[model samples]
Target: MDIQKSKQLPKILIITTGGTITMTPDSTGGVVPTLTGNDLVRSVPDIAKYCECEVISFVSKPGASLNWVDLLGLAKLLNEKLADDSIHGAIVVQGTDTIEETAFIFDLLIQSDKPLVVTGAMRSAMMLSADGPANLLAAVIIASSNMQSQGTLVALNNEFHAARYVQKSHTGHLHAFSSPACGPLGCVLEDKICQFVKIERKSPLAMPKNEIASVGIIKAALADDDRLLKNIPALGYQGIVIEAMGAGHLPAHYAPYISEFSNKFPVVLASRVPSGPIFTHSYNFAGSEMDSIRRGAIPSGLLGSVKSRLLLTILLSLNYSPEQIKTEFHERTEY
Candidate 1:
C-alpha cells in the first residue's frame, strides 16, 4: 500500500486485471496484457486530482478468459479491503468483454455500499487517442464520490451504468458499454461525479462455498433445432438458460426438449433480445412464454441470457434447490 502524501484526499483502491487498458502492441502487432496496477495509476496523470489511489495488480487476463475462481477472488478482495473505514471505494480496471458480467457478479457479492466502479478501454494503450487513462481518471472520481448504495457500476466514456442493466453494445466502439434496459445511473463531468438515478440493489449474496456450478446457455436462432439442448444434463450441467426467441419462445418442436430440461435441471427461460423485459403473459403460442412456463420453465424477467446464465450459475453453486432457484430468479428478474 502506498502511503498517502496528503491526509485529506479520498483514498481509493485501483485494482487492475488484464484488458486493453493494461495492454500495448506486441512484436506481432497484437495487444496483450502488459501493465500492472501501479502502471495504470501512473498512466492517468489527472487521477491524483480526484483521489489518493492504491494499486493492486490482481491478475492479467482477458475478460473472456476469466473464470469463477478469478471472479470470486475479486469479490473477496473488494469485500475485504472495503471493510476499512479509511478506504472510500474501489475501482476495478479490466477488459471490456466481460465487465457487464463481472460487474453484476460483484454487485451481488460485495456487501458494502461503497462505490465500486469497473472501467476498461476499447482501444489499446499504444493506439492514438487511447481512452484508458481518461476512463481510469473518471473511475477514480466516481470511486471517491458518494454513491449512496447504487450497487456495482460500469464507468466508461464518462458515464456510470448500473451493473444489472449494462452491456457491451459494440465490440470496439469507445462508447461500447451501455445499459439498454435502463440508462446509466450518472456520469462524470469536470472531475466531479454527477448523480441522476438510484438503483435499489438486491440483498448481497454469500460467497459460495462451491466456487462453480455447471451451467449452459442455448440461444434460439432462426430455425434453431436446439439440438444441443438435450446434452446439458448428460454433460453434467446443473442449470440451463434457454435464450428463447422473442420474449420466451422456442420453436414449437422444442417443447419436448424444454420439458426434458425442466424435468432434469433448473431451466430458466430468458429472452434473446436486449433492452426489454421477458414477456410472460403476452404470447400463447405452442412454445411461447406462458407455454414454456406451463411446461415447467422459469421465466427470467428483464434479465437476458448472459446475466441469466451467471445468476443461475451462482445460485446453483450455493446449492439452491430447483424450487428455491425459481423463487430467487423470479425475485431478481422483476427488480
Candidate 2:
C-alpha cells in the first residue's frame, strides 16, 4: 500500500512491541508475534489518510514478559522521539496483558504534553475478527489529533481511557479495557474524536538513574502463611505491595510479620477486591488495615496492587525514605 505524501497531516510514530495484535499462528498451533511495525501499518491502509505514519519495530515479546527495565527503555526512547519538532505524538502497540501497568509507567515517566496512546488486541491478528487494525487506526487518530488532553492514554474499542484508571477487566471480550472508578476520558464517535473529561496533568517524575528497584506483590489468602512476608527483604526486594482481603485485612496470625516486614522496607497495602479504596478505620482486628497502617505500612487508597507496586518501585528507585514514601502515597492516593 502506498501512502500519499502530505504536508498538512500530522506525523505520528507507531512503536510496535509484540502482543496479540501482532501475532500469527505458528506450526505448533500456538500464536507468536511475527508482524513487524511496517506489517501492522500495511495491514491498516486507512490510517495513512489520518497521519503521516512512521513505524519502529521495538521488541517482539508478550507484554506479560516485559519488566521495569523494558518500560524505562521505552519511555526514554519515546522522550527522544517526541522531542523532535516534526513528530506530533506516539502510539505504542503492545500486548493487553500488561497494558495498564505499562501505560501507567509511561504516564509517570513521560514529560511530553503531546498525546501518547496505547492500543492492543485481545485476539491474534490472524483471527477471524481480529481487532488490531481498527484499534491501531483509532490510536493513530488520537495520537495525531489535537485532543487537548495530555499524558498517556489507552484507546481501545473506540473508547479512550486515561492510563491512570484503565484496567483489563475481561479475558477474551473485545471491550476488555475499562476505567472502573473514573469511567472513560472520551470516545471516538463517527470517526471524530470527542473528549468529555479534561484531566489535569501532573508534573512528571524524574526517571530513575539506577537500575529499577526490585518490587514484589503478594495477595493475602485464607489462612495465608507469613513466611513469604518474613523473607521478602532477605530476597532482595526493595519494596512490596500486599493485596489484602476486604478493606485490607490479612490473616490475624500474620500481623506481627507484617509489622516486622514494614520496618525493613516500604510496604504498601491495597485491597484485593477491585474498585475500592482501602479502609483505615473500619476494622480493629489483629491483622486489620488500621493495624497494618500503625505498623508503618502505607495504604493505597484507590490504587490496585499492580499500580501500587509500580508507585512504590518508582519511589524506591528515586531513593525516597520510608517516611517520604508514605507522604507521597498519601498525596497520590488521597484523591
Candidate 3:
C-alpha cells in the first residue's frame, strides 16, 4: 500500500447500485440490502481515508432483479459522472447476482479512459463475518489507482476481472466471482491493485440500424412455448437474441420462429449456460447451429444474450448495418 499521505488521491465517485455491501440487519433479524449512500460511506470508513470520494447513488434496490430500464438509467448516470473532469474514476457497489451483467452493459455503452470499477460483497455488513469492507476498500483502491484507468472491471474477493468475462459463481462463498474462459485482468493485493492482463482494447462498438431493435431472451425447456418469437417483431423490435441451449441449439419446434425472426430482424443466437462462446456447426440438426447461421441469424460470437443485447442496442442506436453490428459486436473494447 502507498503509505505517503502527501500523495494526492484520485477523485472517485462511489455510485451505489444497491447490494449486500449496503444492507444491514433489520429489527426482525431478517437481512435486507437497503442502506443509503450516506450509510454506505459510514460502513467503510477506510474508504474516506484512502482517497477523495464523492458518492452518487442511483438505486437502493437489490441488483438481482435488474431490468432494461434500470440498465438504461444507470448508463445515463455513468455518462454524466464521467463527464466531470475532476472525477478520476467511479465505483458501483451492486448486487452480486447481476453485477457482472450490469458491468458488461456499461462496458458496451460507455467509452472512456476514466476507470469504472464495479464491486460487491457476498455477506452483508450486519453479518457476523462480513466481506463488504474489504471488497469496498479494494474497489476504492482500484478506482483511485492508475492501473485500471480504462475499461470496466470487477473487484471482488481480491480478484480483478474484466467486466465482460466475470461471473458470480457461488451463492455464499467469499470468492463468488470468477472469469471462466479469461482470467482476471487484475488482482487486489492488500490495499493495492496489481494488473496482470490487458485484453480490452479498441473503440466502443456502434449500435445497429433498426426501426425498432430489442433484445429478447428465451430459455430452453422440454415443452417450450416460443410465443415470444411470434409476438416480438410486432412489438416494434427489429432485432432478436435467443438464449439457446447447449452449443446454441434450439428446440425442433422453435425452428420456424428462428426462421421467421431471421427473415425480419438481425437475429443473434447465444448460449444460456455459462462459459464458452456460441459457435455455429457445433451441432448437426436441420435447424441446428449450422442452420441458424445459414439463415439470416448471426451468432453472438463470445458474448451472452445480455451483452449481445447491449451491443445490439448501442449499434442499433447508432444506425449500424447488419454486417456492421456483427463485426462491431466483437470489436475490441478499450478504455
Candidate 4:
C-alpha cells in the first residue's frame, strides 16, 4: 500500500495488470509491460489528492493474454474487497485491447454498488505523449466520487463510458474508446466527474460453480464457409457466439449448421455492426435473427460478439440447459 496523502480521503484499490499503460520500450526496441501497480500510482501522484489508494499488482500480461479465469479471479477479488464497508471503490488498470470486455464482465458479476472503473492507455508509457497517467488519474477520481451504482465504467481520453455500450473504436488513436449506439455515461474534466447519462445496471450474476468454460466467437464474412464453425464443437467448445453479418444474418448455407450446433450447444447471434440492436423480426431469410432463434439459437439483443461470448461461457459453466440459457440470455440482453 502506498498512501502519500491525507488519511481522511476515501480509500480505493488500484488493481494493475499488464497493458500498454504499464509498458515501456524494451531492449528489443518493442514495448513490454514492466511497471507495477505502485509504479503506475506514482506516475499520477495527483490521484492521492482524491483518495488514499492501495496498489495491488494483479498480473503483468497484455490484455489480449488475459483469459476467462483471470476475469473470474479479478471479479472475485473485487467482490470480496468491496464487500468491506471501509473500501469505497476500485479501479482496474489493464490493456485497452480487452478493457471493454473486462468492464462488461465485471458489470455483470460485481455485486457491490460502489463505483467500479476500468481504464488503460492506447500508447505505451515510452510513447512521446503517453496518456496512461492522465487516464489513471481520471479513473481514480471517478472512483472516489459519487459515481456509485452506475455499473462498470471505462475511463479513457477523459471520457467515462458504460460497459455495455463502450468499445475500442480505433487501434492507435488517443481517443480510442467510444460508446457507439449509446453515448458516454460521463467524463472527467477539471478534476470533476460529470455524468451525462444513466444506464440500468445489470443484476450481478451469481458466481458459477465452475469457473472455467470454453466458448468460441466466429465472425461471418462474405464467402466464408462453416468449416471453422463445425470445428468449434469438435474442439470441445461448450458454447458459441456467431458474429453474424449485418443485423444478425448468416448465409443461407449456414441455416443447417446453425440448427445442428444449437442443438448440441448454446448459439448466440450477435450483429457484426458496431452499434444497434439485433433485429428480432421482419426478416424472412433462412439465416435471419428470428430464424436463428427459432432454430434454438439465442439473440444477443444489443450485445456484440465479444461480450456475448463471456455471457455464454458463464451460462454454460452454470450448466444451464439450452432452454434455460435462452430465457436467461433474453432477460439479460433486454433493456
lDDT tens string, model 3, 263-285? 77778787887878777666768
Q: Scored by CA lDDT, what does every candidate get?
A: 0.87, 0.87, 0.75, 0.88
Alpha-carbon TM-score of each model against the true structure: 0.97, 0.95, 0.86, 0.96
Q: Give the winner by lDDT.
A: 4
Q: Which pairs, if any, clash in model 3? A: 206-315, 207-314, 207-315, 207-316, 208-315, 208-316, 209-320, 212-238
Ten contiguous residues minimizing lDDT sum, candidate 1? 224-233
Estimate, for each residue in 118-203, the C-alpha lDDT of model 2 and write its tens digit: 99999998899899998988898899899634679999999999888889999999999988878999988877899888677666
Better of 3 and 4 by TM-score: 4
Q: Arrange candidates by lDDT, highest first: which order?
A: 4, 2, 1, 3
Query: For residues 136-167, could you state the per-residue lDDT of candidate 4 as single tens digits?
Result: 99998999988888899999999999998899
Which ranges of candidate 3 are over 4 A from the true structure? 1-7, 65-70, 205-213, 222-237, 281-284, 330-335
Residue 116, candidate 3: how far off, in angstroms? 1.1
Stretches of candidate 1 off by over 4 Å are 1-3
